[model samples]
Target: MTDSTKPTVLIVGGGIGGVALGMLLHKAGVPFEIYERATTVKPLGTAMNFNATTAVMMKQCGVYDEFMAVAKPFSAVQVGNTHRTIDYKIDFSEQEELFGAKGFIISRPDIYDLLVRQVPKEHFHLGKKVISSEQTNEGVILRFSDGTTAEGHILVGADGAYSSIRQHMYDQLKKEGRLPATDGEPLPFSSLCLVGQTKSLDPSVFPSLALDESQVMTVLIKDTPYACSIFTTKKNTVAWAVGEILDENRSKEGEKNEEWGPGAAEAMCQLSRDFPVISGGEKPLTMGDLIDWTDKDYITKVMLEEKVFETWYDGRIVLLGDACHKINPAGGAGATNAVHDAVTIANWIHALPPNPTKQEIESYFEEYKKERLPKAKEAYDSSRMFKSISSKSYLGWIAAVCFKHMPSWMNRTLLSSMMAYRPTVSFLPDAEDKGTVKPAHQHSLETRRILKERQEAATTAAVKA
Candidate 1:
């Protein structure tokens, strides 16, 4: 692509979605820059899961091998009680046969490192927090905290739930009386989580680490507000998480605006350190044991919010991932959905014409929302469903029982619907469909195939001449 035709993209937020979008833009040869508020990237959070759909996307992005190297294939989730005995198991053994790929689990930092390595170091501008943003007829500009500026043809907010770009865009829209009431409302979170991964340890001590496949053991303390989960990753390190159900009416003031603040992590870790865990051992284990093995710097406390905004884009600025839809972490679809958002938006951006007008850009952004919003809403609901089963309320216990006794056929049908919408980059060759179940129709892929045929025909005619 010529420089004249390329639209320079400015991505705010260097998290999974932002970096993943950067990598996709890099593959398309589009000029882009990523601005992150933090001076350094730290490995934070717990385990992240990749279903078959996301695995296909990883393969398309040329990072699947690296991802697999640090990830373990996930087969089942065992829900246990205070006695260290599993109450029920959600088996995923049929995932390979059903989706043509095994689901994998990796630590959040490992995946982030894998993604950022794909993009050039020069593309990232660290410690440049976007204080505000503006857009005129020509392009968009971001004003940073350091009193500097960045100009680009388009601005993307991959900056998590409390996105600066979203705030700036919404402020302008509200002044113009275009912002929706729901969009203007504050993000509400009902649960808080403390998550971290242990340093690589001897597999002999942690028997779960010795297993080839991933094992997720979650222990729910009955009648208590606490739940603890442990997952074994590829590097012989165990990813651990402690969740506490918070009052919906809890004070929003003094809440850490940053997602991975260490102060909150440390406090929550101290409170839940004695929480019991089932670590594939004859003797009982506690979250404190894993905490002792983990680096304190990597621990994070995050408020799990659930919301999908009514307004996603206005003019040249748009939202992606948690910026627009904040899914509950309990569903395990947050990262996967964010990656989907990145891939879909990248396709639309690649389809943009040279020297495009604001109207044309807005049209493509609409197409992106049209394709992604429903999928995101579905994921949001699924995440909430999972969250309910872990709550301390009576409904939570009933939901858990229903889930445990749910018919196998019914469960498979529900999963199939969730897994059917695997999207790939339109500018790249489509990944071969290896599953028996046909995937849902993707507009970008359809356009990709049409363009490929036209390009091939043009090449053939030129050869004949």
Candidate 2:
């Protein structure tokens, strides 16, 4: 029972997903508002990458040129053990071969900044914590903790792993006996993530890093408490993250784990004692150096959690990003997948019929869930498998050997297949991308990568012919 004349969208959370979706909706000439719980938008979180799929979406959304300046696009990645031994290297260094496109390794906050800048400041409501939501025949009404209320045609939750909107949605379902089991505490935190950035370091300490203008390295520790380290550097500074397997410890007071506040920065640093990155130099480089270089304010320590839910929508309310599927940061796929969800949902909304009914909105929700649910699960599984392989155990041993012994060309080919790029929305035009240098072999890789699949009817017609 939405307004026949005006269609409005209310988006919760101002993270990558919400902001990205807002950008798309705005471009599509739809009216929308973004509510962010935080009073201020800050660039935080570990360094993340924008794979080809992400780049394609950004291009479709028309924001490629704006990011090339701040983003560092690299043609190679080096993965190995804690000792700095090279295992499987993805060297698309020769711009001739099509690795599709180099990934943009930018920090999380930077991405937020990029997205927020595009949207009008008036549309973004800061410090608006959505305490509850009510859906009626006309529209959905949102109540903020500040005792304010706002109504919109539909509510989209992009809040994060611990979503207040999701809780409200689940509460409604449980009250109706529709949800049998409680959503429960997040799929037990698989590991704890300790992330921070270092100040400028001299070239002499790590020559390869210095040579490449940026260094990307990962260390695998495969014992009982499995762990992995991701270290990336640009110019004088290095951004690093280390993952430690969390012991299954739950107290009588519910589930007990690491708390991310107060002295968290200090405690997270202490966990990196033996986790060293052995360089080609005589002395080994430890997390201690990076920890000391980074200010306590920049440290991010949290238990990494991942899950893909069975339920996505309840009536006029729908979920996106971490609200729908929480993923480990191992593959840098978390935010990328969230961006994908935003674009996919936005396109569906952009094409809605005039004065759409509640049933019409629910159909779009079903379509979104049908398409993105599987994508979320696929990305989640891939992230977990990669996270596990970053170990020193027998499985890790096999992975390391396969990576080290695997032919480089074959590795590159497998890398292409594993990326599993999703199609972009058909409505948006191609973004102006002057900065991306097309590789020579792009004829086989890049060109083939971007083409949309033929419609089912078209394929059927071809088969009959």
Q: Residue-wise lDDT of candidate 2 within 243-302, one digit each (tens)?
A: 765544632212354455578667767877567764446677777777787777777777
- Model 2 residue runs over 4 Å out of place are 1-6, 90-99, 180-186, 200-209, 221-228, 233-235, 247-255, 258-261, 278-283, 407-413, 431-465
TM-score of 2: 0.84
Model 1 regions more than 4 Å off: 251-264, 449-465
Model 2: clashing residue pairs?
43-109, 200-236, 222-392
**Ten-residue stretch with the least lDDT total in model 1:** 251-260
- For residue 330, what is the lDDT in candidate 1? 83
What TM-score does candidate 1 get on C-alpha atoms?
A: 0.94
lDDT of 1: 0.85
